[model samples]
Target: MAGEITETGELYSPYVGLVYMFNLIVGTGALTMPKAFATAGWLVSLFLLVFLGFMSFVTTTFVVEAMAAANAQLRWKGMESRQEEDDDNSSTASDSDSLLQDNYERAEKRPILSVQRRGSPNLFEITNRVEMGQMASMFFNKVGVNLFYFCIIVYLYGDLAIYAAAVPFSLMQVSCATGNDSCGVEADTKYNDTDLCWGPLRRVDAYRIYLAVFTLLLGPFTFFDVQKTKYLQILTSLMRWIAFAIMIVLALVRIGRGHGEGHPPLASLSGVRNLFGVCVYSFMCQHSLPSLITPVSSKRHLTRLVFLDYVLILAFYGLLSFTAIFSFRGDSLLDMYTLNFASCDIVGVAAVRFFLGLFPVFTISTNFPIIAVTLRNNWKTLFHREGGTYPWVVDRVVFPTITLLPPVLVAFCTHDLESLVGITGAYAGTGIQYVIPAFLVYHCRKDSQLAFGPGAVNKHRSPFHHTFWVGFVLLWAFSCFFFVTANIVLSETRL
Candidate 1:
């Protein structure tokens, strides 16, 4: 009964949806969005901001529906079990656990002592009639699953490189809340040109490493009980609302002082790119996809959801931009804007500021699982061939190492934070999000022209249609090439 709810929307709370969006767009790009505001200016910026929201909505919805459908069919076993899995889908015991935590914990500890073979259990075999599993078999299926698997990894990298950039970016905003002298901006200018210079970041610099380490620590410690953090969902909705309010109040305040204030014009394009990425991330059908694929995702819901989600994303972004623009007085950097940067003691809005400050810890907590897996698995897959049937031998010993790697690497090899982070946008950032999905969508879609799979373009289309797909393929290929080259150049220059 509980498991069913887990798969079903009944157990799927709105806050989980909010986390998806926050995780999707909240990272490093929040800082860079100012650059977009600067490049496009306020007016053009609005349209660009919205355009990203729109496209992401459409693409994400499609990806979610399609990929999830595939996951459902593939995750489980035979046709009979697949059908049973769907029926039990919403009824899965874990689904019930969400409503009652104590019972769930009690259940988890129950011994699997069912004469459980001491040897490696066949992952392929199903003990029950209704079991549907990750159950990877064929090479292509494994590869396909791994492809979507990339999303979780890149998601964190973006947060670390993109969102983490905001710590420094928010400094400038902090300076405004207080004075430059008190904020220590002028003095820090002689020290580090990182996000601290953006506002009141100097105050936190001495403890930034400690803060970063603390955040890193928080992610894994809570791993065994992530759902316990579900209470945070309520807070997420509140912050988003606060952010919305801040955007409005601040935009109105800065109406005349604008013109070309916060994020400029071309920056909007990148804003669009990140939005597109978020939509992809949010619309990702992976978590929910494996359960109900075809019927549950009716075309109507898809259309409405896409439209609504994008509008909200843009609305939220526009607000953030407005608040940051006037607050910084036009000197804002792309990777340095935190909502709390200018906020220390505004009694009325102090809560918003506090959460803004807490945002990094949240991101690190959410992202570390994916990073640990990426670091550990990639380590084993690439370097360590020795494997135990037990996943823990690999997962436990090396997961902590992966968590600690980022700080250690950054500490050892110092580089410009903004430029260094922006550079990641080209490689892991590019391939993990953009290139991989585009390939999956194109390949899986029945008539997609760029499908790397066997039957993409079929006998059905007109010459014009054929030309359109061919052109589309070229466009993606072009983008991929550019992204790869950009990374190479950026990495080389930094080295």
Candidate 2:
């Protein structure tokens, strides 16, 4: 009880919020997004960026609001806990009364930041009072939030493995790009290339094992105390942005020069393309919109914070997509420039191709944990419980590990990137990123209140803000589901 977080849902420090958002968006997409430009074309890809950006904002806002609800509930529970402590002989009645009086006086006397407590329960009761039945509604809310997180975890692990499989296949091709006669050139018509090379470290079946490891590591990463995990978050984020730039360059080089004959991005399968179907849906490592609405968020500062995030997200994504589109050949998508680089530059473009080729590895390394956290917090808020608290280790490690296992196993078993991407994108990506959020948001908005919060330097609150959030989530879900599913069906006979 001593260490119990009595006042939950407090907005974490701004640094954490900013980092978290950045982290989420900048992952595997860095490598794969360029390929999207190739398929959709620059114009379509830009539109995709805009559409995804807007939906992602809305979904992020909804998440923020939901977090606020949970945090507020955490605070309320804390108040109740104190009441119980007082009743259980925390001190003599006289002492308690005196302390109460002193607290009242001190609260009034504290600095300007300490405002008068004026908010009501702010929770939806099945029927306003009895307090206990509210538990059910609370449970539903938390479950919804945590459920979202769980899906994300599932999606990321499977996604990461699928992407990772592409890496080795790309490495194999470096030899011929430099005009080395030693590099056996495979016949394009035959769909056979002798110049391609796999990573030196891999076994014929290494993909399976790698996928398992990448997928399962979410536990060690996420459960290790997020409070102190800032460093790893930063490192990953840097990698993400750098990768983004590299992707753009790759796309530009291929798309710009009129290669008399177009080269197909070696990764032509639909499954692999899903990595760029929509936004990264990452847990940004830093003043993200989600943090703005958490119960702990300073009400005075909420509006400005949310809008700032919206702008930052828009700018980052829009720019990245634009550059990526310019980097590829028009006719060929996925890895259109697959044969453009020689083996000598294998360290350069080849490394880029490998990672870009392997989207899931980057995703599983990060996104799974973020989504799980989303679920846990939402669960607590909905249930309004300190009891049966969500276990961090389960989602962070066990669940994520389990989710990634199949991809890794498949990679090793088949060494086939095409199959894994198709299955995961059709099933997991479709449901998690697109369908579910959209559905949940629609339901929430049907009978709700609130509007989007204000811009920064202009802090203000809106009534029925929750309603707006529901709408936002729905947008993201639908986008993800439709785009991913369509592509999967196109690429695979199985899906």
Candidate 3:
């Protein structure tokens, strides 16, 4: 059961792999981008979004290279183990004396087995299933591996908080009776906790109720194993495409009809902080590359496929954000863009309005449980001792309780999805996407050089293989953190 849960059988072509990556990167973050674009101004948003996308693609290549190197090392170790077993079986009394000498020589040469390979193509075989955790163990020191897990855990926590808030927020938007039902109505009427919902309960109270209901329904799944089947992915991808297409076309039509009310600025330094976070969040697929890339039938053009995927995603985000900023005033765009179409004036048909409004509900609901289960597993891995079994209470109760609580409590406190995404993407997201990959590739290259020698070539190395690229990424990550921190300090001082 554990093996089945962990292993995703290789069942996809390079094209399918591209699509899967595209879907993975362009999730909830993309939905919130238009508002960020409007706030940062279109020009700054465009430059930053493109730049961030390029950086994300670079790190993606880095991860892929590390994965290949990991596979090579694992293969080398397996062959060495088999040879040792054979030697043990075939040893004779006469050979015992020579065996000691051979052992000394082997002890000297064993480290080389990981880096130096004979002239066999099989030595560089890419069939191993080296997950990020396993690769961290292989390449990173104990501290680095723990840091990697910690970064991932924090990012996943942010994901859960965003998901928890988004679903309930969407529900409140569509089901609550108080909001205007017509599209392009008054744009400034922000609903508050005091706003009535369903006769007696206020909107904030309704939101909490939804959060509790959400926890009750999906929280239990965290205690047990869960896998997202191919069919589930296909269904969600289908819904995503349909919803996005409707939005883009609807916004374009509205603009063509001269109904566009938005005049976004060309640049806004004040909004750059959140915009940075949103773009970082949108281009996040680095942490999931192992599951995404490993199943490809052929990876000769894996880099090209990933590049194309990012290109499409960048184009999609640009189109979505551009249309949104043009079609609606900056203040009017919802955190979840699908809500924009959930009115009679924009979408006309009641069915379409409800479908678009509830899109987050459908998509995020499926994801919340999966993410919760993943967070639970990460906790187990973090404290797991070798040859040790966890107490049933710890396994089934404590981890799930911790996993389900913090994010839900966050959702309970506020449904500020934009700030949640911005902070998550800016900090933890930056670490996972930028800083960690830079270090991973840097160290992986050093390790490969030590194992395979300086002249050894890695087939999967990034096009930006120069050591300068690593420094550039780390430098950029530092600049971003510095800028965000300064912005926060400055904003609070002004307040």
What C-alpha RMSD separates each model from the true structure? 13.1, 9.3, 3.8
Candidate 2 worst ten-residue window by lDDT: 451-460
Cα lDDT for residue 403, candidate 1: 44
Tens-digit lDDT string for candidate 2 (428-489): 65555444534433433332222211211101223325545555555555655566667656
Q: Sum up the clashes in candidate 2.
A: 69
Query: How should the candidates be ordered by lDDT, best one leading?
Result: 3, 2, 1
lDDT of 3: 0.85
Worst 10 residues of 3 by lDDT: 1-10
Error of 3 at 471 (Å): 0.7
Instruction: Tell me how far the alpha carbon of residue 458 in candidate 2 is from the true structure, in angstroms, after superposition.
Output: 16
> Per-residue lDDT of 1-495 in model 3, one digit per residue for the tens?
112222457457788878888899989998999989999999999999999999999999988888878877777678779997877775653377787887787679776554345323455556667788888888889999899999999999999999999998988878773253434223434667787877787888888888888888888888788899879999999999999999999999999999888999999999999999999999998888887787777788888989999899999999999999999988888788888776666777777888888899999999988999989999999999999999989888999999999999899998988889999999999999998888888888888777667767777878999999999999999999999989989999999
TM accuracy, model 1: 0.59
The better-scoring model by lDDT among 2 and 3 is 3
lDDT of 1 by residue, 322-346 (tens): 5555444444333344442333322
